[model samples]
Target chain A: MINYWIAGIYPRNAKLIESTRLYDKTLKEQFKKEKSRLLKIQSDNKLDFISDPLIDWDDNLRPFTNSLRGIERGPLTRYYENNTFYRQPIIKSKIGTSGNILKNSICFDLFNKKSKVKIDILDPFTFYDLSANEFYKSEEEAVNAFAGIIKKELISIKNNVKLIQFNAPSLARVVERDRLNMVKKAIENIVRGIDTKTCLNLWGSDISNTFEEFQEFPTDIIGIDFTSTRVDRFDKIKMKKGLACGLIDAKNTKMEKSADVIRELRNIKNVFNPESISITSSWDFEFIPESFADRKLQIMKQIKEKSKMMKL
Target chain B: MKKFPLATQEIGSIRKPRWLVKLLQDKNVSDEVKEEARSDVALLNLKLFEDIGLDVIYDGEARRVEMYEYSIRRIEGLQLAGKIRSWDNKYYNKGRCTKKVKYTGPYHVDEFLFVKENANRMIKLPITGAYTLADWSYNEAYKSKEDFTIDLARKVIRPLIKDLVKTGADFIQIDEPAATTHPDEMQLVVDSFNESIKGINAKFGIHICYSEDYSNMYPEVLEMKNHQYELEFANRDSWNKGINHSNRNGYESFLKTFREYGEKKEIGLGVLDVHVDEIESPELVRDRILYAVKMTDNPNLVHVNPDCGLRTRSRETSFAKLKNMVIGTEMAKKKLQL
Candidate 1:
């Protein structure tokens, strides 16, 4: 039977917003309060395994650019897409990570208590491609520079981390095979000698365009956005690493039927029955309202039960 | 007899009054009562425009909720299914089309007619463009984004434009803020726009602003049926303090595009910045307009306006900005000796 771990990229849903109770408190206070509440909710859910709650009450609005703003040399702008705006980190100078990059952002309150926790970070290529490169000479150099900085940060926290998923939607956008090679090099640099299981989550575009390049990634697990990408063609490819099949549409409020989700999972299991398989939303639940996200998770739990009954 | 050297107008929408906003927010107010209040507010906005002495004016969109939602709510074959983030801490109640899009009725016609009857001057009707209406919403039922966008143009936008034209609206501005979001699909945008305004007989224009990928806008955009391009240049004037376009990096590229291809089209130069709270000095607005005139190389084709809508700011800010815009246009007219 498949392990059937349920996970998500980020947990900043609308329900979290309504329940967080942020009135007059500073962003720091809100972050801590929201973090505690998120951990409690996740603990209550009692899933098999979980990822970081991304209790970014402080940095959720600007996530990547907020990290850069703390540093001396980060120029940022609004990233407009999907009815949401993220701060596009504009590289105005040599990129460097401040010690306070993810300090107050991460919630370790539920650490080592109930389930193994995963931390998600922006992939080196995504970090490079999404930004305005003023300092770096070339795209490759900027990616590598970003990779080196991220590598140092990961190496320090690799012991406690069960898995480190790199959000690499930018890789999916690349049409050229040569640029994919540069992304591969950058990924290899970031994960060099790390013990933690590395997962690469790609969304916002079809992954099949860069499937050949994705196969070359050094990560231990790969996530496919089955909602957006035609996972029907995926059976032909002989897969090796664990696969996280995104069966839920994160952007839509309507919940997928549990049986339909299970059927999709079964198709993926038949194709690349690798080390294990996990079910997840196509992207961040933040794209959806809280009630819908909660309903979607409920459907995921139902799908897990159905999958177990099928004994695939 | 002529007002100023170049025509001065608002892109669309003025700042909504706070008391009216409070009344709208009150759930106890009946829909009938709320609509009556909104009509009163619309009349107030129309009077305000005439008082400001704008060459072309709108009802400030006082009766509608922003641009996109108002249309979505009225259009058939659409449903508000989810909430999506528009920007930092701001989310729009978004929807999608599950069936073939059809015309529900004339959503903007009543609003347009009300303004037309009230305004003493020429009034332009601003409708959310087909591309933006489709682009901003999720595509649930459409076979392809291109097909869906075309459907929107033919079924939704074209009818609205025709109705507005039939109602004697002299100018109709299609707001396509999402046009350049996907640079690859700009061809689709242009094609769909042509389809929307296909048989509509009115002076049509396109309004685009705050798009991050404005640089990716291909020269082919000017090929649309629009006679004028109303864009926001003042919003991009963040780094500069004195309101001069010399410091704006965007101004140079925009100038190059207009000078190369804007000979046939009128350029509504946004001389006053709307994003900032600081009211621009008339001299600054004059300088920005003068700079835009010099860059475009066709002062006759250039017009003066604010960068974008003033709906987000206070009512006083909106009026003051328009006042400064008028004063500055007069200053530029003197300098140009027209």
Candidate 2:
């Protein structure tokens, strides 16, 4: 069971960050900084799993922004929460990767081998949806191209990674049935040749509508955000594989008590039993302050310890 | 009948001069050095507005960074939480409220006072709206998003408006680019917008854009005490491949919404596109304004401005755009015989 790993970017420790290097740092330096920060956070909390920290691609197009050339920066638009804004990458030319995207970041050692270091990639659907496609004829074409590109990257680094999580909030956001299938096909295309344990983390919309399809998804694990979706709906869907229960609230700063989290996980256990269960945040930890984020992780660790004693 | 037919206004935030941006970026500079640099450019920004013959002008938000973050740092009880991704890979330094938000005096008053003292023409104050600040921020103190927004409006925003109005601000424009981002939350925006302007003695207006559905805010938007609706149109214009050449007609969809719901209110028609580098000709601006006048069936109800703020554009482009807007409005005034 992989319990209590963080998903998405960890908030930066403000005391350690230099504002001048925000956009000036080289890719190698950024990776070193991220690993160091994650290691510090892990040691501080005594966490089991190594997290990628998502600090590497804080302001660049993740999983695809290999270089700064051939991409135009779109105007800053409001994120769903309205507090943060991302400048979307406009694909001005053919999208391709020149090298291994996650080589420098992932650490392989005795402690890291004992527990997998989690790395996140923007799912093909979201990459296509957020992009201004000037080259592709339609969004479907763009998705297909992106899937092939992502599949190549995944296969190249399949051994180095312990878990490959696809950030697919777009799949949950799609309303039309046909569009949903296209996104699913795109996901299927991206994960075709990968042997790493795969997890599809869906949020920002209800999962009940596509619960049956998600259960049959060709991946090792499935993550459902309990913050945005109702837990009662999960009773009807049976999990045949690993389940990543997003128990931590990502959007708000308020932390849930360990007892409350344990109770919720116990209730989830009463439903369809899976091969394994993992605990994580509902979404990105970047939404909250760093101190609060550390507290949230500590609460998750507490839940992990309490769950062990309870023996669900 | 109206104070000025085809009134020319420059939306808040002309681009920062390169030297000014450099001065702000340098850490070695003392506080006095940066303040001097800011004050000089602010006066220059105001002088540019006067030179271009703008009817209503602002100091271009010279003292601020962006719309939301600058005002947020000044308010009481809110703290910089962490950076969060808005989309793709772009991130912003976001904030969270630790306690009940309070008006910690005025943030933009000094900037406004400088503009008010210098500007020879009518000046309008542009402030980030309550709903936008609430919607963009992390809500920790309130149980519901609506509750947080309402408290922000009543406590932080209303008092700011009251202060600005008390300081002889005749016109106040609240910029809410995040207004219609969520269709369901438009009610929160409308209700809180009304709450923000309550008991304020000034001619109020709202700026909403980059949203597809302005209609959702309407009927409820009509309920607000504001007088003008400044919306982006030139950015959405479809190009017409005419017999001779091509031209941009941004107001094609502009009239469709205004005709249905904007019968009683004034419209600040955006005739220039700030997202692009192509300077709009006076003829194109005149054509867009004419289209608005024809479609809305009221020439007096239309005021001319850019689609959005010029913060993204170069100073040269912004100045030329504003100059063309004034000239185009003059042409429209002559043509309409208003």
**TM-score for all models, in order of appearance:** 0.88, 0.83
**Which number leads on TM-score?**
1
lDDT of 2 at A249: 91
Candidate 1 per-residue lDDT, tens place, B63-143, comes to 888788888898787777655555444557777777778998788888888887888887778899889988877677888
In the order shown, what is each candidate's alpha-carbon RMSD?
3.7, 4.5
Worst 10 residues of 1 chain B by lDDT: B237-246
Instruction: State interface RMSD in Å for all models.
Output: 3.8, 4.3
DockQ of each: 0.38, 0.32
Alpha carbon RMSD to native, model 1:
3.7
Look at candidate 1 and tell me the lDDT of residue B126: 87
Q: Model 1 — TM-score against the truth?
A: 0.88
